[model samples]
Target: MTISQAESHKHLIRTKVWSQLRKVALPDSRFHHDYSSFIADFEGSSAATDLLVSLPAYKNADLLFIAPDNCIQALRYRALKDGKTVLVTTYGIRRGFWILDPNEIHESKWEMASMLDGMERIGRHIALAEITKLPMDIGLMVTGTGAINYKGLRFGKGHGFFDLEWAILYTIGKVNKKTKTIAVVHECQVLDEELRGEVWDTGCDFVVTNKKIIEVEDASKPNCGILWDKLEEGMLEDIEPLRELRSMKK
Candidate 1:
């Protein structure tokens, strides 16, 4: 299929999954109207987090790279409580990346620090160059998904922020082959059909739901760094981190 056709198919899948999620997803007062536009906070999010923490990858990892999705809030809280450092991007990656170290936060504020609003307030802003200078050993990488299949193909909220984030990290050597990637979603979000993934699509090694854990065999992920030609227009101008990264590359 052509690139246009492939994208259209992915959009259809996202729309269908979003509609299904709305029925069972927990209500978010912050985004009451446009549930489809954002990743739905589905029921059993806490349960999913519980399962994720039980994994060996999570237990052994000192640093985690988590996406800024509402469903993964519980996981973030648990990570901090367990004394794990988290690397997260601002919402839509609009403001760039932040480093949330458990050592820096007060124990009483961990729960608050896990939330998006709290993360922005409490987390320290780290530039791209600074991040590269830090330790690059990320053991577990978790992201919230709009839809995923047994093959580990994942679809986000149309925007490619997560994929870009991965590319940036991979390019900077923060993420390596040993890093275990997982996608947390509701059972309803797991698709039976094989998704046609693009070259730049980032897949997961595992899919965690409230019900069970699925270990994907040979998950597909981007093998290269940033695909400069595939980036959206004005992304560099809008996201400071990207601009900083671009300058570093030059």
Candidate 2:
């Protein structure tokens, strides 16, 4: 099926799963255990091993990860505290709620604060780097899967910003074989189908959800021209510093 067709199908599934989750209200204890299982499983898994073997030393590795909220996997703070350099996006208020960075949320800052705390738990030094300023040698891009509907392919609310975020990194030559891109989500989010590829979507090498870590093997890389095109579209307009940097690049 075409990418658009796949996206549409996944969108429907995501809506269904979300409705189910709301009716059931995932319990806190279950959430905690699933996250813990992922941390433990990945710690000894091939994905983790491959990441360390392939990438440069984390002692100097620049890491970019997301701050999670809205029922995403609650990654423990221990991992964050052990990293080298960390980067985070800012949260904004929308539709009577506060959404985490680059997205809209309708809730209070308390949830956002909790997400920030998880990001801080990694305890790595903060480096306010945009996609443009991202050091050429970033070792990993770890993200928490926010409401991945559509069988884990399409991202939250269809803005496609997360894929753009990765594409920006790829376009700038910051991500390569050695750079690890991992997503943390709950088990239920993993779809039973291939995540449809698109011209702009950033394909992840590792998926760490509630059940286990899924490593997408022999994954297709984003097209260079398409990636640059994404970078050219004044996509960073909302990001002030990024906008300034892009202007300088121009």
Candidate 3:
């Protein structure tokens, strides 16, 4: 299928999943828009996080890269409480990346630090060069999904920020073949159909839902770094980290 055709197909799947999630979505006063506009916080988000933390990958990893999605807020809190360092981007990565070191945060503040607004207030913003110099490797990377299939293919909110984040980390050699990737979603978000993923799309090694844990037999991740030619118009000027990263290549 052509790129346009594939995008249309993905849209249909996202619409279907969003519709189902709306019925059981947990009430969050922060959002006023539809589920399609953002990653909706569903009824079983906490349960899914419980199963995620039980995994050997999550237990062994000292550092994690988590997305700033509503559904995975619990995971972020748990990571900090467990004394793990979390690397998170601001919403849409508008402000670039921040590092949340558990040691610096008080135990009473972990819950607040897990939130998006609170993260901005408490987490330390780290520069691209500083990120590359961090001593510890990212052992587990987790992202919230709008929809995912048994094959481990996932679709984000269609903004492509997660894919771009993966590309940046891979380019800097922070994540590699040894890293384990996981997607956390509601059981209703798991679809039965295969998704037509793009070259930049990243897949997961495991899918954790409130219902069960699925280990994808042959899950694949992107090895290529940033495809500068494929970026959206004006993206370099709007995103500070992207702009800095581009100049570094010169």
Error of 3 at 28 (Å): 4.8
Highest lDDT: give the candidate number.
3
- Cα RMSD, model 1: 1.3
Clashing pairs in 1: none
lDDT of 1 by residue, 19-80 (tens): 88888787767776365556667889888998989999999999899998888988999999
Evaluation by lDDT, superior candidate among 1 and 3:
3
TM-score, cand. 2 vs. native: 0.58
Estimate, for each residue in 160-199, the C-alpha lDDT of model 2 and write its tens digit: 5455555545555666645656655555555565555676
Worst 10 residues of 2 by lDDT: 92-101
Models sorted by lDDT, best on top: 3, 1, 2
RMSD of each: 1.3, 9.3, 1.3
Q: Is 1 or 2 the stronger prediction by TM-score?
A: 1
